[model samples]
Target: MSGGLIGLSGLIILFVLLIIRIPVAFAMFAVGFAGIWVLRDLNSAMSLLASESFTIASSAELVVVPLFILMGNVASVTGMSARLYDAAYAIVGQIRGGLALATVLGCAGFAALSGSSVASALTMGKVSMDQMNRFDYDNRLSTGVVAAGGTLGILIPPSTGFVIYAILTQQSIGRLFLAGILPGLLLLSMFMLTVVLLCWLMPGFGPRGPKSTMREKGRKMAGALPVLLVVILTIGGIYGGLFSPVEASAVGAGLVILIGVLEGRLGFARFWEAAKSSIVTSATVMLILISAHLINPFLALTHIPTLIGEYLSALDVAPMVVLGLILLTYLVLGCFLEGFAMLVLTMPIFFPVITQLGMDPIWFGVLVVLTLEMGLISPPVGVNVFVVKSVATDVPLGRIFAGVMPFWIAMLVTLAILVAFPQIALILPNTMIE
Candidate 1:
């Protein structure tokens, strides 16, 4: 059989494995290893597997994964996330649909710290859901807000999605991180506007919340200062050349831990638990990345990327048209695949085509990550929706999906805006990073 045929078969089997509920790491590993063995030799496959695993395991750049995760975990355990939510609430909770707006803001804030959609959704859901419910907010609006807001985790700085995309495409992590800033804030604003519109159209969807006194708002903001400062220092440090991404991760984690200790919010036992959770999450990411490395080589050996690139290049359509088609493909796949899996599985095939068209990889990275966020709320495999459902068990799964639809449309608008004006993603990376 031809190499293409073998690669095609491997992908089919990999999809089958995923459909049957095999873990993503194992599925990719199995398909990649088998494909290599068929095209080359068992020894080659084995050596590649061993070397890739070790390389990914020992990667210095990836150290940010665990450290950043630890910062988020520690923040969650030590009540920093709660305080951040309180601050947002004090500032906006009095307006109509303000609590929902605050949830989105909180999710954005936590996204900066955690950089995981699931973590952002889970943490913000716990922190904001009850508060929204107490204000008699519609479950659909409340659940939808959390689910959609959590997706900001992947688009904001320190995003694992960007890290994986950068590693796969050989782009700069700092540049990708910088590229995400404006777009992330844009999406956050879009979500807030969606909330305002929803409440305007349906007055009962989210009632007006009680206003906070200026002193109360000031006090709440004061309480949230530590988290806000950590967010600023770590992300600002990266943009200002004060620290590399790795060093920023370490600094953020250390600051959060120190603050927790000083406030008597995190004892040794709680810190240990947070660390353990971070290790587990980091391990999962590392495995996916290693498996992705294996799969990239396997696909390369099959010449699949070359073939796809040729096919795309031969098209009579404009580059932007081709780009739109590729993004549409991501949106369709997002319904079925986890964001990172989609990135690893498609980037090798798509990145070559994108570069061939002379498109900017950093901008493409931001667009891809943003599409992945939409998937988090898309039905069937909407991971963030399920995450919100877990937090609000009394709310039916369907309602959460329904709630997220408008926000999903809002995301579509944000995606369109980004597409129309690529500068939203490229400006910071271009002007600030050099």
Candidate 2:
């Protein structure tokens, strides 16, 4: 069979495997290795697979993955997430829908520590759900906010999404991390606005909590200061040229461990559990990266990206129009696929077209990450929604999905603003030290 035909068939089989509950890494691996073997030879396939796995695993830059994951997990065990939530709640929890807003802020804070959306959602959900429940807040709004806010984990600085994108596109990881800051804060503000607007339209949905004393507020804020300091030092270190992204991850992880020990909240058992969890998450990411490397070569052998690029470039529409269509494809795909899966599956086809059109890669990275954030809260397979459901078992899945609708629209607005002013995503990266 022709290489194009084989590539097409391989892609179909890969998706079929995914739909049948196969892990994405294994599916990509099986299809990729097989495709390369057919197009080239068995020896070439085995050689590429072995080399790619080692190269990805041994790469010094990827140390950020487990380190940052460990930092977040340790923070969670040490009760830093709860302190952050309490601090946000103290600041905003008294207003209508304030608890929800606090939830978004808490998620943003947790996102800074943990780059994984699932971890952010699960951690913040456990921290904030009971408080929202305590105030007789609508379950839909409560669960929805946690699910939606959790997605910020991947758009914020130190995000795994940006790290993966940087590696795939060969862009600077530091610049990508910087590029995410403005867009991340923009989404956070928009999410808060959605909560406010929803409460205005129906105050009963999110009733206000009793105001805290100024002393109480100060205490909670003080309680959260340590983690806040870690966030600032790590991200600020990158922005100030004091640390590379990998270096920043190491420092952040180290500080979190130290704080846990000093506070006596992270026991040997807890620390070991955090390390084990980070290992599992990191291993999964590494396998996916290796599989992606194999698939990239197979796709090149088939000339699939070149074909798609030529076809896209030949269209009569403006480049921005083509970009819009590509994003729309992402929107449609988001409903079914997880964010990382979508990135690896589509970037090989789309990233080339993006560069061919002369768009900035960093801006495109932010845009794509935003779309991935949307997917996390989207229907049919909204991973964050399911995660929220897992934590708030009393709330039905449908309610959680319904609650996230407003925040989803808020994300759409944020995306439009970023597209209209690409500077929003590019400003920090453009000015960063080379």
User: Cα-based RMSD of the predictions, in order?
Assistant: 0.8, 0.8
Global lDDT of model 2: 0.93
TM-score of each: 0.99, 0.99
In angstroms, what RMSD does candidate 2 have relative to the true structure? 0.8
Candidate 1: misplaced stretches above 4 Å?
A: none
Backbone N/Cα/C clashes per model: 0, 0
Q: Candidate 2 residues 1-434, lDDT tens each? A: 89899989998998899888899899999999999999999999999999998999898989999999999999998999999999999999889999999999999999999998999999999988998899999998999999999999999989999999988988889988989999999999999989999899999999999899999999999999999999999999989989888999999999999999999998999999999999999999999999999998998999888899889988999999999999999999999887888899899899989998999999999999999999999999899999999999988888889999989999999999999999998888887755
Off by over 4 Å in 2: none
True lDDT of residue 316, candidate 2: 96
Error of 1 at 297 (Å): 1.3
